[model samples]
Target: MAQLQLGPPPQQQQRPAQPGQPGQPQQLSPQAPRPPQQARPARPATPSDTPPSGQPDASRDQRRRALPGETVAPAPDETVIAPPRQRITNPTAVFSGLDKITGRIIAFDVAIDETVQFGALQVTPRVCYTRPPTETPQTTTFVEVDEVTLNGEVRRIYSGWMFAASPGLSGVEHAVYDVWLTDCKQSAPVIPGQAQSQPPATR
Candidate 1:
């Protein structure tokens, strides 16, 4: 049989302090390895953010500047002038007469200030003008027409300008006849033993 020895339930082994200062921290036990603390990442700058100076980029200013020895074009002339339109004047004005009763259409020429009879109407041209062949054909005449009554009485019917291109706007209009200007020239051809314009039979 052995003798039992129980002084104090065996005491934990203590580490002896090899300390230097008075308020120094003492080691308790092996500390658990701490997780490494990660560093915060820095933010990147954006293009939309304006700089402190508020000035435009140097690259853009260089593009706007003119290069040396560059040639510049001149501006075009602004004012434009046109030549005048040419016209031709004639001594005689030619006309076409329509007889609604006889269904006859006859073309005749009349000299300026001369009176010519067409059916019961007398035509007198005051002025006639035309354009050159190279230009547009515009035959215009200032004329007067008189109507003769059955009782031998004469009265003015119409008097104004007439355009050949537009016959409906002519100066002469009668119940049985219509006269429109056709052309303007120096003279008309003379027929053998016949006058260019037939005179009205003696009343």
Candidate 2:
């Protein structure tokens, strides 16, 4: 046995571990000193010029407003309105009768509530009306027609309104005589002995 020397062991050290030191390494403990910490870089501030999130920009608000002294008219209503129709009354209704077999056409006038004879038919006008001259001309008449058959039977043939503007639409289809309204007037020149109103026949 050799004599032991030194107050501290070479394999163990109480100091903190140092770099580039030779021999046995030193163990770190709570008493060891720490290195100084570096300061963190400052955070950049946000731009004040830009608008905040979730908001409309200034340019959009300008478009919503009208220009200076400019008139902004209100929106127009969607409903549409129409004018009332006006019609004028007349005293006489002028008509044209066509005889299919003879191909003869006769023009005549009958006063309201009076009947005129044409061939075997009696024509009576109830109403005669017309539109204003400034407006579209439309002459109309409500008339009744009776056909006297060979058996002395006065059968009702046609009873409806007749339009002067469209004669084809108002006529007796199968009868030999067809009468259509031509015009409505206040008075018509008298045709001497041409048309005579018949008295009511006794049953």
Candidate 3:
């Protein structure tokens, strides 16, 4: 018989199976699990982002500083000055007299010539007299006229007449008598028929 040597009974060799497949359980390792990631903190504000506590508001300070060389525009709340109110007095004819009358108020009728068309007529009456000065007359003279209210009512005075001129009177209208006088001086009596014509250039 030939020498037959059996090293050992034929050992059955088993092959390791692949993991994560049907009927195969996955093998576990000894490594530790990783931790969750944390979010970064927000950056703090710098000096440029926040103004100092002692400083004024930025917008207001800018406006005030801009006013030195530049004109600061007026605000809507600013007050505006209004023009003085003008009252119409002496509407018709201006009268004058020679005597010194004081506190004498009278109403007079003026007869404007209707034949000749007076172009843009203007009349001025002044009481001329010399009086002793109580105080030294200042170089700058200021004249004020005292007004007399009629029956506690205000009447519109024109250039000369105490009341407004008659609406009917016109350049072609003749013999229209609507003139009146008021607030005459009591001490001076007006010289009647002593009226003098004034040149148109005097206006």
Writing each residue's lDDT as its tens digit, candidate 2 over 91-177 gives 889989889999999999899999998998899999999988788889999999989889999888889999998998875664588
Best by lDDT: 2
Clash count of each predicted structure: 0, 0, 22
For 1-203, candidate 1 gives per-residue lDDT tens digits of 99786553344235355456477665544586656799888665455556458787544455456477754332232244657888888899998999998899999889899899988989999999988888888989999999999999999999999998998886565789888888888775344467567768995
Ranking by lDDT: 2, 1, 3
Model 3: lDDT equals 0.34
Model 2 misplaced stretches (Cα beyond 4 Å): 1-75, 78-80, 193-203
Better model by lDDT: candidate 1 vs candidate 3: 1
**Residue-wise C-alpha lDDT for candidate 3, range 1-203, written one tens digit per residue:** 79785553344234454677798796655485555688888777553455559876554565677855786654343466856443322212333221123334334322221111111222233322122244322111011122224355422233322212232221221122122222322233334778788868864
Candidate 3: 10-residue stretch with minimal lDDT: 137-146
TM-score of 1: 0.55
Candidate 1: residue 130 Cα off by (Å): 0.7
Model 2 residue 164 CA deviation in Å: 0.7
Error of 3 at 195 (Å): 12
| Whole-model lDDT values for every prediction | 0.80, 0.81, 0.34
